[model samples]
Target chain A: MNTTQTEWNLARRQIVGNAASIGFAVAMYGVSFGALGTTAGLSIPQTMALSLLMFTGASQFTLVSTLASGGTALTAVIASWLMGTRNAAYSMRMTPILKTSGPGRLVAVQLTIDESTAMGLAQDEEAFEGRASRLAFWATGLSVYLLWNLATFIGAVSVSAIGDPKSFGLDAAIAAGLFALVWPQIKSRTDLSVAFGGALIALALTPVVPPGVPVLAAAIVAIIVGWVTGRKLS
Target chain B: MMWFAVLAGAAGCYALKYVGSIIPAHILEQPIVKRIVLLLPISLLSALVAVQTFATSQSLTLDARVPALAAATVALRFKTPFILVVLIAAVTAAALRYFGLAA
Candidate 1:
């Protein structure tokens, strides 16, 4: 849904409503991520950097848990990178809508995560009335980014005062949140198969391989599935 | 090591995003590449679920998190919000742990 400049004049308030809701939801997770990061032994600044740079919740959590579980730096990076790959996929879709370069492109690409993309594309109605989607994108992205970072900082600081996070079962909270994040993406039969296969592969390999390797190794399932799908389409 | 991990992971993840941003849409739209891209996050996230719930480094454990995950699954089926799903799972595990049921 490419948004034209002439179509962007409205800068509708409806976009803000959607962005705020998404922002609030993410604000909750930002707190969780912040708390989880500290419990994973990340300093506030380290955790902040993750929220700031990586910006995506799944990738940040992946990095924390991987490193905490004694995965090597290489594996940690790769595993988190794998988790972050969806943004790349999101980026591919966002490129046309964003249609910017230089400094603007840098900022837009950074904001190109699930929330913004979802909001942006939601306006791609049956007609070519993709007018408000770009506003949705920018508003949702900026708001989520700001709220998430602030909440993350708050969570990081306050969690330490809460004593051992396990008592609060924050670990389970993190996993559940992550599963929720991915669940929306599981919309098709192929997606289901890949998820089941990936989890199976990871579980089987967990006891055998290093901490983060199984996560990476699960890519085999996706590759095979993709290959089969591609062959069918061709 | 952690500092390196954090910084490097951020760099690499952003680089991936940059690649997607810069790549020609036609190139990304290649059937195989598109399929693979779509599936990567699905597989990786499920792999993460298995890892998060069951495994700890080179070991495996059966803990309160097991039932907690089941509860989370139910919450998902009911279409609970993301944070609520997480809260339900957390409370499930916490209560189990409190009662000395699971470890």
Candidate 2:
């Protein structure tokens, strides 16, 4: 039952399709981030390079904003690193679902991120094919990576001819797109509680902490609370 | 100069991704660590939304942008398609901005 052939094929197809969907959505948000990077004094090449290389949207945004606000390069790097540390956790949690053999294992790790990891894990509980999980992660990550870099390049090069990208509502569009991705997943009391805890913590600490650090702090608090809740329930 | 940072950052990011799988399964399966790891996405994503929605240039706004939050709430409640909810939020925000009511 756990490793049936037909089920594996179906899961593979579903994962691929969802990966494409997630990839396309994530790519759309790259336009906004690219514009933002340029406006923050990043050259087109730098912005595109960031998109191509860094590939984590939140961390990229955090680094640029921190730098723009007079943060040292080291500080910006640290902040971004802290923000993106979730990928490490994602990789740890994903081991059971994506236990690939041979060379493809490397690809699985590279592709693991918030969306792919989350989607893959969600499917795994339903016993999705291990291959499907890997495919989804790669398809989504590669698609987003390519689209993001390309979009950033285009935005950076066109900035002089274009007016404020914010005025074009790019920020809102991206925010909306992200919300689109996130809103569907807020199920159960546990999920809601963590969200509430995180939001409250961030709001409370925003004035005291640096921009991105607050998010990291809130995340820590949320995880603690969630762990405590799970223990209580058990 | 920035490219150096970018390249270094990217390399670091990719290298870190593979670190978990390379470690012994026992390391990843530690009960406490496993619990925390499993909760990472929920916590991180929640924090991201809180920062984006509430903090605006170091201040919190309860204006038209508020509708984006509200729309998200309603969409989640009704189980509407995520894309539709986002579109609604954007439209609501644009209307608020149009009326000179939002920051």
DockQ of each: 0.73, 0.35
DockQ, cand. 1: 0.73
Pairs clashing within candidate 2: none
Q: Count of backbone clashes for each model? A: 0, 0
The candidate that wins on DockQ is: 1
Per-residue lDDT of candidate 2, residues A51-139 (tens digit): 77677776676666545433446655655665566677677778666777577777777677777777766654545435565566666
CAPRI grade of model 1? medium
Give Cα distance to truth, residue A202, candidate 1, Å: 1.2
Best candidate, TM-score:
1
**Candidates' lDDT values, in order?**
0.84, 0.64
Candidate 1: segments with Cα more than 4 A from true spot? A1-11, A124-131
- Candidate 1 on A1-234: residue-level lDDT in tens? 446543344447567887998898889889888988898888889999999998988888888877766678898888888777778878888777766789988988889888998888887632235447677888999999999999999989987788777878887887787788789999999899999999999889888887888888998999899989977876
Pull out the clashing pairs in model 1: none
What lDDT score goes with residue A102 in model 2? 71
For each candidate, what TM-score against the reference? 0.91, 0.69
